[model samples]
Target: MGLRPRMAISDIEVIAPHFKRRLSGVTSTVVQLIPKQLEAGVKISTLGPGLPDDLPKLRYRDLLQCWVRPSSGKKRIWHARRNIEMVAGIFLRDVLRMPMKLVFTSAAQRNHTDFTKAMIRRMDGVIATSGRSGAFLEVPHTVVMHGIDTTLFHPPRTNDDLFSASGLPGKYAIGCSGRIRHQKGTDLFVDAMIALLPHYHDWTAIITGRVTAEHEGFHAELEERIAKAGLTDRIVFLGEVDDVKLWYRRFSLFVAPSRNEGFGLTPLEAMASATATVTSDAGAYAEMNVSGSTGMIVPAGDGDALRNAIEPYLADPGRAKRHGENALAHVTTHFEIGGEVKGVSAVYEATLAGER
Candidate 1:
């Protein structure tokens, strides 16, 4: 797609506030979406701490600039994806008398706390990240599913020697990524790999995520189990990879065994990388993949089911490549990154005109 010239500071139309410093799903969403918005000529800038230095960001003191009405629009859109950011936006617009409209993106798949509902009710507009999330909302919201940057996560030009390039052993790799914890179902992934890898010597399994201090015991136990099974070399743990996009492209099958999720973009990330996936029915994995064709979806937290889903690919690498090809096509047709940014752009326009 063509990028419109980046809007100047004076002409900025949107303020994407990210209060959290951690690299969470919400933070990742902002990092992915802002540049797209700017490329589309929507004069956007990020605000708050913990964002990458590469993003166009306004200083905290720049919050005062919102009080100045834009020459072209009535107010700026304060797009928020978390409660703290949303609450701050409301206070800026209402109490501080800033010329801004609050828009909150809700991704929770179940009922929310009363306090959260009360906050939602106060927003100028709300966006549900998935259709499933809309059911759990008390206030009205537009549903805009998350999308992946196809350019960043596409099929490699040639991956015949990817393992050699990655400097890891084995000809083929299956990977599961996310935080190392029981809720993320990392244990299930480890167990399944331990049970299956002995037969598929050509295939190695990798887990890429960090184990927090609180989950040290849980992480240690999984390592002990793998050590006892004598599969340490095959079942490897790559804690916290900054280049996860590269890792996704190296996998034959990308498994997301999450026990629960608000909504996950990992399946799409895997698909965009031209990797076949075996994901749990948690989050939007089922919605993202055409089960059994493009990818597979198993029952959440079921090691046996996950292993069964992955066995055929281990037996037949060619079929796995075909599935990966299908995944790239499916993601391109339905979940390209531009599709998501365009949807939100429309909302911004309508809401600016007081029509949303």
Candidate 2:
């Protein structure tokens, strides 16, 4: 799509807020979803910093115009994905009396805090990312799982030399991407690699994502363990990367061994890249993979189970390739971005009509 003119505040039917300045999973979701939502004819604009310059957005001062209701008789929708944004929505609608309805999307699988529960109770509509997350909510909610852009994440062509250019010594790559922390099970993945890589000499292990100050000790511990195993050369860490999809393309096998999560998307992204996955039963990971056909799923936080689940794929490259193909087909059919846009748009329609 080409650059478009700025939209009038009165023309917007939905305002998605990205309150956080740092790039995160939620920020990525907002960036990916809005363009598709607009393509599907939802009159939406974002309200916050940290978004692309090309995206339709409102100025901070534009909050004053919210008092002027949209051209449609129905109140505009204020879709908040974070607690802070929810508070902002509540203030605008309740205190300032803006003509807007509040909607919050919950992705946390754990029980809600009383503070969070109180704010949720004030929302006009709620959306849960998965059934597991929905089970924790006290109020009524629609289950609308997230999806990825299949066209952007598909397998690399035969002519692609992405791995060779990386200069890493391996014919195949096994990857784990996300924060390097205990909660993300980065140590479990490192342990699995230490146990399995010696048997599979042609494969190399790659870890990507940021390491904040609080987790620097955990990151050091994992690196030290790999060094002690004398596999430091075999297993590599590429800190945080700008082009994650390219790395996904280079991977023949992907792992997501998180001890806990809130509707994880790494497995889906890997699957879309035609990379087979071995993931723990955290968040919506199990729901995304078809176990034997697409990949394997083991109990969360079990090191033995994690290693064993990934062993079969390591033993046979042909088996991994077959499952990777299956993964591509499954994701293309079930988890395309359009499906998510449709589900979310329906909720917006229902909320505006006082039906949700």
**What value of lDDT does candidate 2 attain over all alpha carbons?**
0.91
Counting only residues 3 or more apart in sequence or on different chains, how many pairs clash (N, Cα, C under 3 Å) in candidate 2? 0
Q: Which parts of model 1 have CA positions greater than 4 angstroms off? A: 1-9, 158-161
lDDT of 2 by residue, 121-208 (tens): 9998999999899999999999999999987788977545257667899888999999889999999999999999999998999999
TM-scores of all predicted structures = 0.94, 0.97
Q: Tens digits of per-residue lDDT for model 1 on 1-356? A: 34234335467778888887767888778878877877788778887888777787777776667788767756888898888988898899889998888888888888889889888888887888888888898877788989888878877767542755877789899999888999889998888888889999999999998888999999999999999999989999999997888888889889899999988888899899899999998887788888888878998888889889988999999988999999999999999889999989877877777764
How much does each candidate deviate from the true structure in C-alpha RMSD? Answer: 2.7, 1.5
lDDT of each: 0.85, 0.91
Write down the worst ten-residue block by lDDT for model 2: 157-166
Name the regions of candidate 2 deviating beyond 4 angstroms.
Answer: 1-5
Residue 122 error, candidate 2, Å: 1.4
Please estimate how well model 1 matches the true structure, expressed as its whole-model Cα lDDT.
0.85
